[model samples]
Target: MIRTGNEYRESIRDGRQIWIDGEKVKDVTTHPMFKPVVDVRARIYDLAHEEHSRKVMTYADEETGEANAIANRLPKTQQDWKDKRAAVELVQREAGGVVTRVGDETIGEMWSLYDGQDVLNEVDPRFSENIRRHIARTIKGDPFHISANTDPKGDRSKAPQDQDPDMLLHVVKETDSGIVVRGAKYETAAAYANQAFTKPTIANWGNDKLSDYAVGFVVDLGSPGLKFISRNGFAGRAPAADYPLANRVDEVESLVVFDNVEIPWEDVLFYRHTKAAAFIRSTLHRYSALPFVQRTLHLADLMIGSALWNVKQTGLEKQQAVQEKLAQLACYREGINAHLTAAIANAEASPGGLLMPNQSLLYTGRVFALSQLPAMMHTARELCGGQICITPDSATFNDPEVSPWLEKFYTINDNWVAEDRRRLLAFARDLLNSDYAGHRLTFQLFAQSPPFAQLGAVYRNFDWSGPLDLVKDAANLSEKVNGSL
Candidate 1:
């Protein structure tokens, strides 16, 4: 069930429509804007077959007696959760940067739906069997899966019918074989990924029983009517030496337009069921949040490393103030680590009999990691000093006439050479102060969901009755207060 890097590269050359900066992209595997991340994803597939990483990236499937990706396996035990985490960490480490939405992080959205088979059966019995088959297919096929949730909702004041009906993705027509959907979704990695579990964003489904908008299905990225309009990418914009991370790990986002694209009946997981849609929106990230929050943890480590190296090069670590700042960074890193570790340890059995990280702990961990990211980035920026922003580009450092003067000022000691110092500054600058840095920060802020929706997940998951019961017992309240509990 494992594919090599070349095999993966060949799979995405499906002649799908893709455009960037008004230029058509013929091959995502080789396009300058997409190749970096595409190769990262390709490496993920290759890692499962490599000797050094295969043990961690893959497992033996009992049903087929074959090697399948650990990332796509059903989480039936706690060890499975641990193995999934290890696989994702291996990919991030190998890529030299974090790249979310490749496969592991998004496959769990389907798992979340997998856990809702009962709801699916209630609407349509075939829908339950469809999800089961898809999950199994993902394990056997190991395609580059991604997610699609948000639509470019035109206006909030009016209903979807009042405004442009295309603002939300809906079932336009149903034929004998399948349903034809027409709308657009803003999906990361859609330009290069193989498929997407397209669904609706969180919405107020106010008292509706059934509607065309309450639809969810797997859309093949190579479908005839699909068009990928991507934003301008960061790669090839500057020298790799000056913007290494951007050039190597920028995952291009795209607006995937579905112009009457047909999703086969076998691919449809749910349809025309408001209850099913609401159920999915509530539990969309149940398993996926582990990988999503883990990305933040990786970012924290990078921030800490960049800041620590800058202070070490300048001999600033000797100062107590600098040491305290470094301590704060360490605290942030370990806080994320602790949350992730504890979530798995306290894992609970999901309704579908799969093991899920503790819901309260997991959702709160996501909130803690995302809410504090901005402040922590600011702290890391301050620790790196003002030089990260002011340092000259690599071209100036390599210039013949200016090299001597620049080297004299940049070199701090025999151990810290000018070239090394410049390199660290450039790295720190890209991590903390470049256009890529800003975009990454914004991506993390709203990647899983917006701030309000994130907090709402915490609200819905946290057990408020625990506090209420304690307060009532302490105050010796009447039985009426206990009635609600």
Candidate 2:
């Protein structure tokens, strides 16, 4: 069943234990901080049913033969990769490059893959059918939002098990029906968005001591013992008039607490299976990175457009320096898009018949995104100059007494209207100066991995030998030329 936007909203109308600012939110749909993000998600659901986007957003499951979220349908061939990429790009574009997080769809897709692995391992053939049905339901139904919970709190140097064990989400007990999991998953991005589909932050390889922690399972958001403590975004509270974008795009992060939460056995994908857990994490990381690259490309496109628009609005487009800056922003945007194109073009089928992007290229793309994104933000800030900070609040500009004086003084270049120019300037301020902007910039830096770790991953995965051999061959040719002379 293709769930409509309203239907999806209705599904989560019931009470869930979500806390914000030391208070439990009674209605997540109506909460000031959560409502805007929910609206954004609703747009995604609406797109799935729209005539124009339905084809890209919805896909028929080969296993169940039902139309579902393209995210949940694993890509099996080269065309499959293209189709999935198209779907991802469509969502990012529809959101106006505002919704940059790619994990939204990727997490569920990873879970579906893990579920498939479980189904294959089941001794009874009937369990495979059950698993297939579960996947179909997950794809078709509105599952809760997904957030990867890998960043264990505290010092990064310690292994998860070696660190304060309680900091990591580990299993406490087991039951006939399910297992009891206790501990917390921190910095979860979409804790307030849905009712189900949440899982642990990272994979637990089951050594004897870590056996209980090796569990992976799903739970409804309103499950008995689950609790969510929400965190604020920059746009959470500026007066609606002062910060319009803040009101619309305020994303909330929360610490998802599982206090002896019972997760049913059937839903458990990996338990006391360290090897499988490692595979699950690695597989998810590899596949999920592609969509993120696509999303980053979208963001680059927006930043570039916003920078260019600001330049033109300020009448600086003709300046050689301004044009050069715009061109640099354009180059960064195109570079990201180029890498995405390469990753998609070089995709290959996995053992499970799912299409996987080239690991090296995909990792390289992520590395580039993490390094390039902050500079892109910096460039936007540099181009906009002091104007972003100096722009008066919308309310001040709207005041009858202050309006004429402010407009007369602030309006730049005879071609641009004061109001229009102010709006763009305000937007740039919100983009670069606001807390939301800081959070977004921080998110991009560490989304795939930490900056240094990302560099390490690139070094480990990249084939320096081939490039070195080429260099050596060139050197030999140069040496031979000198000898001949």
Candidate 3:
């Protein structure tokens, strides 16, 4: 069931309404802003069929006798996680840059459906079955999937009914074929992806049994009323030689307009069930958080690499102070590494018989990776020196009149020539100092919901009773403390 790169490309050329920079895109697969990212996604698909990668990227499904994407397979054992991690690392290595939302990261949310079977079953077991089918389709069809949440929620003070009801994407009408939905979601890579695990954003966990706004479904991005209005892209903004990461790996976000879009009954995962909605909001990232945090690990590596290389070039490595700063960066990197490693080693079994990373370690790792990212970037930027910002563009480096003068000033020795130094600084700039770098930092901060929600996950998963018991035993408190427990 695995597809080739060309097949993946042809699938997204389905005449979906997509706009960027005030112009309607004719074809996402061929458009300038989207071509680079789409090509990268396609290359990931093609990698599976290649000789060396087939084993790493896919596993044979016993029931169907077909090689399915390993990323989409239901994790049952610790080895499944190790395989998924290896596949993700290999894909990152092959891409030459970090690329999230390729497939594996988003597919984990479907597994979250299994975690919520009890809540969703009260809505209807049929909806739960729909989720199961979609999970299977992801493995067999190998479609590009992405998460769709975070609507343009207007006036947080006012309820959806008080303001424009469409602001939160409520059900407009129910047809025999499906329910027609009206509203939007801000998502990355939605303009080109095949489908989305569209669901409710953060909600007030009230006891309301049913509401039009509390809904979850898998939406086909190419459907008739779906419109993609993408933010301006970072690619093609400047020369790739100077802004390498942005040009090849900047994932564009879009505000997708769903104007009376029809969701066939079969595709509806949950409808008019606030309990299901609240349950989903609390556990949406249970399985997905690992891959999301793993992307930050790659960013950590890039930051450390940029800093260490800069210090090495300037002979700063010999200084004890420089070594201490570099070691701090290593600590940050290994902190994330330790969390991910321990999470897998102490993996927990889910209610549905799937293996998830240890909940406490996984969520705590997310907080560590995201909460400290800005500071880490700052440290790396400082270590890279002031040259990353002050350096001229590639055009200036190759200029006939300026080239010789720049060469004499930029060159340190035969080993550290002007060109090599310029390249490293340019890379450091794109990784830490450019517009793309800032945008990426913002994306990581809130991509899996906001910092507060991440902390909430850790709070809920962490065993508070253990600390309470320890304090009670130490202080010799009355039975009242145990009653609270």
Candidate 4:
């Protein structure tokens, strides 16, 4: 059931509407902006079939004995999580950069829905089977799936009913086959992804059990009524040598307009059920956060390597202050490593019999990773020094007149040549100082959910009882203290 790279490419070229920078992209696989990322995604598929990666990237399904993506494998054992982590590390190594929205990260959103079958039953037992079927479809079909949650809310003060009814995606009409939804969601990689698990992002449903906005469904991105209007891409706007990461791994975000988009009955996961919507919103990132936070760990590695190499090249490693800063970066890197390791080490059993990373540790680790990201990046920026910004482009380094001057100034010693110096600075610039770097920072902050929501997850998952008991024992309080709170 695992698809090939070419097959994945052909699947997305299904006449889907995609527009960027005032021009319609003809073919995403061939477009200058999308091609690089699309090719990276394609390579991941190709990797699954390669000799060395065939085992790590894929597993034989117990029932069918068919090869399937290991990333899509339903996690039932701790070893499965270990294998998943190794597979992702292999991909990031192969890709030479980070690419988050492939398939594995978003598939967990469906697993969350699977865990919510009881909620699905409360609304409509018929749709409970929809989640199971869709989860299986993703594993067997091997589609490039993504997430859709954020809608362009018109006004925060007014309800979607009081404002433009289409502000939030809502059911516009009920057809014999399914319901037609109207509105748009901001989704990354939507233009090239095969499908999206569309749902509400609203945190509070407020007792409205049957509101129009309370709907969730599996949407085919290539549907006729779907329009993908993406923000301008970072790829191909500059020299790849100067902005390497951006050129290869910029996952373009789109405001996908669903103009009377019909959701076939089979595709609808839930309908007219506010509680169902709320349940999804709260638990949406439960399993997905593992991969999402795992990506940050890789980024930490990149930053540490870049900074350490910069210091080593400049012979600044002997300085104690510089050594301390490097140690700080290492601590940050290892902190994330510790969290990821412990999360799986203490894995928990889910209500649906699937294995889950310890929720408290996993969610708290996410907060630790994200909250410290900006500071750690700044530290890396400092360690890399100001050369990352002042360094000239590769063109000047190769220029006849400027080449000599750049070489004379940039070349440090026998170990570091001008070409090597230029490439390193360019990389550091793209990683920490460029427009793309800023965009990446912003994406990490808000992509999964906002900072406030991340904190809420920690609050909900952390066991307050243990701490309360410890305090009660320390203070010599009465046993009644247990019931007071």
Q: Model 1 residue 188 lDDT?
A: 98
lDDT of 4: 0.91
- Compared with the true structure, all predictions reach lDDT values of 0.91, 0.67, 0.89, 0.91
- lDDT by residue (1-485, candidate 4, tens digit) is 89999999999999988999999988989999999999999999999999988999999999999999999989999999999999999888887777799747988999988999999999888789999999899889999999999999988888788778888999988989999999999999999999999998783356667988889999999898999999999999999999999998999999999999999999999998898898898889889999999999999999998999999899999999999998999999888889889999999988778999999899999999989999999999999999999988888788898799988989999889999988888898999999999999999999899999999999989888887888889998898765333
Give the least accurate 10-residue stretch of model 3, judged by summed lDDT.
476-485
lDDT of 2 by residue, 1-485 (tens): 76777876787776768888777788777777778777777788888888998998887766777778776665566676677778877776665446644225445345444445653364334334534555656666746446545534555466667877766778877898887888776544445555334344554343443365555555666677877777865546777555656777666767777888897877665665555445454555567777777777777776777688887776788999988888888888878777777877887656555667776787888888778888888898888888788778888898999999988977776777788787777777777777767777777776656777666656765677676667668777554332210
lDDT of 3: 0.89
How many steric clashes does model 2 contain?
Answer: 3
Q: Once model 1 is optimally superposed onto the true structure by TM-score, how far is the C-alpha of residue 268 displaced, in angstroms?
A: 0.6
Better of 1 and 2 by TM-score: 1
State the lDDT of candidate 3 residue by residue for 1-485, as single tens digits: 89899999999999899999889999898888899899989988998899989999999998988988888889999999989988888878777677888758988988988778877789999898888888888888999999998999998888788888888988989999989999999999999899999999865436678899999999988899999999999999999999998999888899999989999988999999888888788888888999788888888998898899888888899899889889989999999989999999999999878999999999999999999989999999989999999999999989999999999999988789999999999999999999999998998988888989999999999978878888888988987655243
- Clashing pairs for model 1 are none
lDDT of 3 at 169: 80
Error of 1 at 457 (Å): 0.9
Q: TM-score, each model?
A: 0.98, 0.87, 0.98, 0.98
The 10-residue segment of model 2 with minimum total lDDT is 476-485
Collision count of model 4: 0
Evaluated at residue 252, the lDDT of candidate 3 is 89
